[model samples]
Target: MFEYISSLWSQFLSLLSSFNISSALDVLLVSFIIFSGIKLIRETRAEQLVKGIILLLGIWIVANIFSMNMMKTILSYFFNFSVIALLIIFQPEIRRALEQMGRNNFGKKLGLLNKEEEKQKEKKQRCISAVVDSAAYLQERKTGALMVIERETKLGDIINTGTVVDAIPSQQLICNIFFNKAPLHDGAMVIRDGMVYAAGCILPLTKSNKVSLELGTRHRAAIGMSENSDAVIVIVSEETGQISMALNGVLTRNYTRETLQNALEEYLSSSSEPKTQKKIPSFRKAKKS
Candidate 1:
């Protein structure tokens, strides 16, 4: 056994010495492919299938070493067929991986793309300003309103429940929706990709103990929806005529128009940094009278 091991090591060294740069690169590329495949399998239920394949390969290796011709031939065919079978079985995951690769490439090129993004962001800021201004105006007139601002997470599920508007946001349009007898006044309005996507949308209601009793259904619903998503919700109280904002399940109350505008700008600015800082004071943590 020792002599056999020494002979195998000598043969391996001889093969290594004979390898060209192209062969070395091919080996490195294959190593990376194997590593990535293992990682992908580990991340998904496909690991079980991989284990089965590995076991089959191991059996084949042992069979070939032992001169079991029939077993070697059968296993080789199974192994060859598995490559095509895996492509079909993991099609969705493969597509997602390719999409993620494309997104990463796009992100790397973002410096060149940022000018266009900035223009779109400028447009969005104007829309946000309009929404905030509309909410403030509505608050003064005691017009109840619910405005949902989309973030990283898609609000497609919520948007599907409401009437699709797809209109450019304006103060007049928002005010009209929440007017005394507007048909869509009863439900929330959803904004997505700088457009009002839907109206009269029913949002989930928040059940946070931290939420104040002074807050009505609109505020609770706003907090609820925001908690479930990465959305920013602006609520105008019909009874108290106050402006409030809800994010990540927390509500901030008594926002002046300027404060609201600044909060939106700070939160919505195109910075890629993760937001850990609170944009507004928590309603529960307000100073005692």
Candidate 2:
């Protein structure tokens, strides 16, 4: 026991002596990277997948300790094959991660992109006003409408589903697009950088069975689009003329002209902290969809 204790003390002292400012910095950098990776995975679907992988690794360790040849062989084979499977499964997430890495915010922080961002902000306000006005008009007359406003997350996929409008936003134009009997009324509109970017676009339906049966296709599509991206979606129900807004998968309903304007203003403001995404509270809780 004394010999073992002496050996540990000598090793510990050696390690302490070798430790320096450079080593501390190296440890801090590695720790920061690990923490950031955990945060990123936690924010996405990868968290569950990572947890499953860790569980499998634990089981494999146990199997090895017990000398379970059958279990060990199966787990080893599965791990050997999992690399390719994981690449395919996490392609989207991997691409997003790479894109985020490439997007150095130095330019934006130095106000280099301020001109473009400011223009976008102005355009966004215009689009918001047009949407709010159109929604009010539709709600009053019970015209169903679906409008998607893109934010930082590029919505090129969603935009491609519809006819490119590329027109300046106006309440009259938005109302006309969704005028019930209009050709594009059955579809959705996409607003990017405050421009009427696309119309008559088809949106993906939410796969979540959590959506209420009472909701229609427009509301479901809005929720689905919001779930898939960081866009703000507005829906005007045809049947009840109810106004609803969806952001980050949550739907809030019963928005009037003033309240909807306020909600949009609150959410659409440029956040100073670009590292963390922001979630705004709803004006009012809609039906739990």
Model 2 C-alpha lDDT per residue in residues 1-289, reported as the tens digit of each score:
9999999999999999999999999999999999876765664567678889999999999999999999999999999999897898777567656655553456656665557777877887887888889999999999899999877678888778788998999989999999878888889898877889899999988755567888889988887787666678999999999999888667888888888888787777753322323222223454231
User: TM-scores of all models?
Assistant: 0.58, 0.78
What total of clashing residue pairs does each candidate reach? 0, 0
**Model 2 spans with C-alpha error above 4 angstroms:** 1-12, 41-45, 92-106, 109-122, 207-216, 271-289
Write down the worst ten-residue block by lDDT for model 2: 273-282
Cα lDDT tens digits, model 1, 1-289, are 9999999999999998999999989999999988876655553446666678778889999999999999999988877888798898777446535533442334534555478787878778877888988988998898889999887667888988889999998999889888979889999999887888899999988645556777789988998786566688988889988888887556777788778887787766643423553422246321222
RMSD of every candidate to native, in Å, equals: 9.8, 4.3
Clashes of 1: 0
Candidate 1 regions exceeding 4 Å error are 1-115, 272-289
RMSD from true fold, candidate 1: 9.8
Best by lDDT: 2
Local error of candidate 1 at residue 265 (angstroms): 0.7
Best by TM-score: 2
Clashing pairs in 2: none
